[model samples]
Target chain A: MDDPLMLARVQFALTAGTHFLFVALTLGLATLVALTQTRATLSGSAVAERMTRFWGQLYVINYAVGIVTGLVMEFQFGLNWSGMSRVVGEVIGAPLAMETVVAFFVESTFLGLWIFGWDRLNRWVHLGLIWVVAATAYFSAYFILVANGFLQRPVGFTMVDGQARLTDLGALLTNPTALLAFGHVVFGGLLTAGFFMAAVSGYHLFRRTAEADLFRRSMRTGLVAVVVSVMPVAAFGGMQYAYIQPTKHPGAQESAAQVAQFEARFGPGDYTPPGLATAGEVLMEVAWSLMFFLAFAMLVKLPFGRWLERGRVFHVLMMAALPLPYVAMISGWVFREVGRQPWMVYGVLKTEDALSDVGAGAVAVSFTVFTVLFAALVVVNVWLLARFARRGPEAVRLGAPGAPEPERPALTPTF
Target chain B: MQTLALVVLAVLTAGYLVLAGADIGMGMLLPVLGRDGRERRLVIAAFAPFFLANEVWLVAVAGVVAGAFPGLEHALLSGLFPVFVALVAGWVVRDAGLWLRGRVDAAAWRAVCDGAIVAGSWALALSWGAVLGTVLVGGSRVEDGVNAGTVLGLPLALVFAAHGAGFARWRLASGLAERARRVPGRYWVSGAALAALPVAAGARLPWSQVVSSPEALAVTAVMCVLMVPLLAAAQALVWWTFRGRAESPGYL
Candidate 1:
């Protein structure tokens, strides 16, 4: 905790991690919106398009905030972890660079066109731009994931003069951990979006505010998205990730060996073994297992989720399950990064080498400030979205026959 | 293997040039592309929505360079410290220009914003050129690693300008073509000089060791050849895509 490097690590971890939840939600929800909207258009159902636009609008707002949070992340490299950049800047820098060029550019460009171009350009063409935007988001995520994967299990590299050289670009590109991590991350986003979408649709159902068909359709789509996307990761992703972070399993062995050495120094009866390390790993494993089981249980109820519409069991239960995935995600990231402890860029430069000489007070201070700001953002985003959501698409459009009507004539605003 | 990996880096760098270069060029050439205030606004609008994400390429390129070739990353960051600082500062200022669009009605403010961003873009583009010049012309006298080239005062600056101009031509191909048509020769000269620079030990690009060992050189050679025509074609494509008075889409 006293180490500048340690403080920097925790500071960035707290900030990056808190913001990560928002990003994943946007990534998954936006895609789901795109898919639903596309289906609506193809099927000549304006209901679907409205559903798409509705969820998409909320997602884009969340995305805008996420993007700002992400930009702040870049600055942290220059400010907090300049040492890491100095050492492995050549190798990891390329992907970060390319993500800016290829992925970020493509996403932002098309997203603009998608947002501002709506109705001004061809409808299908606008949709295409969103597809580009969504793809680019995932692409950006991929580059970062690959870089992290290298940190976990550095392959195709060599050390020279206390620094790491990326001797093997192929190995970095094809690391198995990178792929699994990417899948796990993307699917988790989809699941978050699913729950949010389902909840919104359910809210509409309870209020009797919008057309029942549209709300029902949204519910169905969100349920299917959640059930299908979450199942693979819950059932398989955990196992795959567990393997990659071998640190999660071998702590027991390490502690046992340490105890044995201690016993050799003294009589067995004279000394007791402290099994703290094993306890930690076992706790992590149990948490992960419990999360998996919970996800599985929710998914199992999907076929019959429609039946529980009166009770709204599925939406309530899934939202309850959100924290599980988040916990696992944070655990997975910690297990992966910390699991490969002692090395910032495996085997090339130890974490000890790349730490800056910053004080812990600075880290703790910044962490507290950002935590407040992020908490505020979360509250505002949720509140804004909820307020907007309460006014269904139909409420803004046509009112019920007996309900109060607008003062002005009903005319769609021309672009 | 170092030689092979260096080649991969070169390719990645070239990719960076193609993508990010285009983006920066677009940002800088907005003034030149638009004939009037309204047109300029449209131009800014066109590129504005994408600037931050567009800059992500710089991040990725830096990540790879930092991670893959730590030695080069170190020496280069130190050598190009001024350029790196300027590049980042430029990025920040350019963002200021776009984000400030709603707050300012003063023609002076708009003019200043545009000028700062365009100047920043030019500086960023040239910085990369200097980097390429250094990579091409100089080498480290090391035993078993990739060697970086020296960055001379004059030739490096000129070559950097040439890289900036070439990228601008490609990015603003629609309206600003003739202003930069003379850059290909300068580019070819820079490329040749860069190619001829001496190295104590040979370096490899990413794909060269496996497929492009000797027989594979042809593909890269041909790829370089295609670059010229592709560059020329890009200009035509730019005009074809944006030749109209302006198309105002609603959302981004």
Candidate 2:
């Protein structure tokens, strides 16, 4: 704890993990919200519109914190891990920059339009903005994964003058390490959204809210989303373990030669990952197994809508089960990231070497500040989400009619 | 490629200063601009829609620095670690306040959030000016202690507040606009402050020395070239859509 390197590492883990919690839900809910809005636009269904507004409100609330945390995540690299930038930045930086341009820039702009465009723009154009937002949200995640994948697998780069440089864009983008994880993450997001929707709807039904029909449709959508997405999440996750891990990980079956090469090149060191990596893997697998069974139960209940709605026990179970996907997803992330331990860029840049030249005190201060702030923000976020969720669709002001626009006075020529 | 990268970086930095600066400034002056809770909510609604988009320019600037000028990114960020820390903390608090202020319908909750907005905004504005001051005096290394430019940070923060007041003057309606108008040099102050950021940055950093490989630079530069125009169009659309004054409080 006194060591700056350890402190920095812990800080990164905590901050990034918290940020991912928001991102997972944001990515999933963005898609769900866009789809709901699309249904409303095409069919002109009032229920669908209300659903869009409701879900959209939740999405926006989550996204609000997500954006701020993301800003922290961006600055963190330069703040604590400058050596990573100085060494391999030529390789990974390209994708990160592309992410900023292709995803965040576009995503924010379109999202603003979508938020404020309510009754202002053409209905189709407004709908298109949301789809753009969702697509770009995935793109943002993809590019980030591309950069991270390079760190995990060290592909499409060649060492020049002791610094990594991009040798092939295609190789970087298509690295199975990145692509497979991207798939896993995307489906993981959907599953999370499915569970979140189901849980929120379940809470409403459990309470015997007046908006029973609205929640019933939402509940069905959530359950069906889970059924469709859960298997793919498992499949992609399985492929990553079966295929990518063996080739890239130090202790895995196929990477013995690579491990030997690393040992010879870097001299004596504990090149193997920590025990926490294995624990993360085990935890993730356990959570996923439980979620799979729960998903199966949901699928079974799908055929009998009225019975499912009336089963207060099931609703309570769903509300209880809400944390499963979160646990699975986070643990899975920990498994993947922590498993790459001791190497900031696997086999290329050692973790300690990647740290910025900061003192333990400074790093500790930052660590405490960020961790506390994130925790507070998360608490506030969940509280607000619960409050809004309980209030249901009627409380949504996302697309609600506003007071009349105030007349603009003539601009005083002040320049 | 390096020049193109620098141009992209310059553009993004200036854009953030001009756009996000206003909102941060407005946040800083929330109490002065709006007298009561309802009035403060109105004050926030004026800039809420544009805040997300405005802030992304700073994100883009960070991206450009990390991608194009990797060495500088490492040096500048780690060197001024404390400043960036404060800036980021303020950013988080201010944004949270803005997002959460209207969620709950309690006077105390809104007040707490409003206080967060004020304190966070001030922190952000001051830290940003300090960043410029530190960089201007070549305090790009931790060893470089306080200098003249560091002191200049105070006045620079004031400039941002003035810039924000200018924005409020433009975007607000009736008494709020009148309140903002009491600040001297509305549009002129805002324009000068916006123009000053890039100029100061340009004067301090040696752009040519810090660039990445041409291949890497070219890739990012190309993406920026392709997307910037689209970004501009969308940004214009947002400005156009919300061109009118704050008629009522928005979905804060």
- TM-scores computed on chain B for all candidates: 0.56, 0.95
lDDT of 1 by residue, B1-252 (tens): 444445544554554455455556556555655544444554554545345434544454443344344444444444444444445445544554554432234567567767766776666655555545454444332212122442443354454445445544443324444444544524445444433332211242222211212212232233333333433343333334333422331122
> Candidate 1: where are CA atoms >4 Å away?
A1-3, A241-251, A254-309, A313-315, A357-383, A394-415, B1-252
Identify the candidate with maximal DockQ.
2
> TM-score for every candidate vs. truth?
0.62, 0.95
Interface CA RMSD, all predictions: 10.5, 4.6
TM-score of 1: 0.62
lDDT score of residue B243 within candidate 2: 88
Backbone clashes in each candidate structure, one number apiece?
Answer: 61, 0
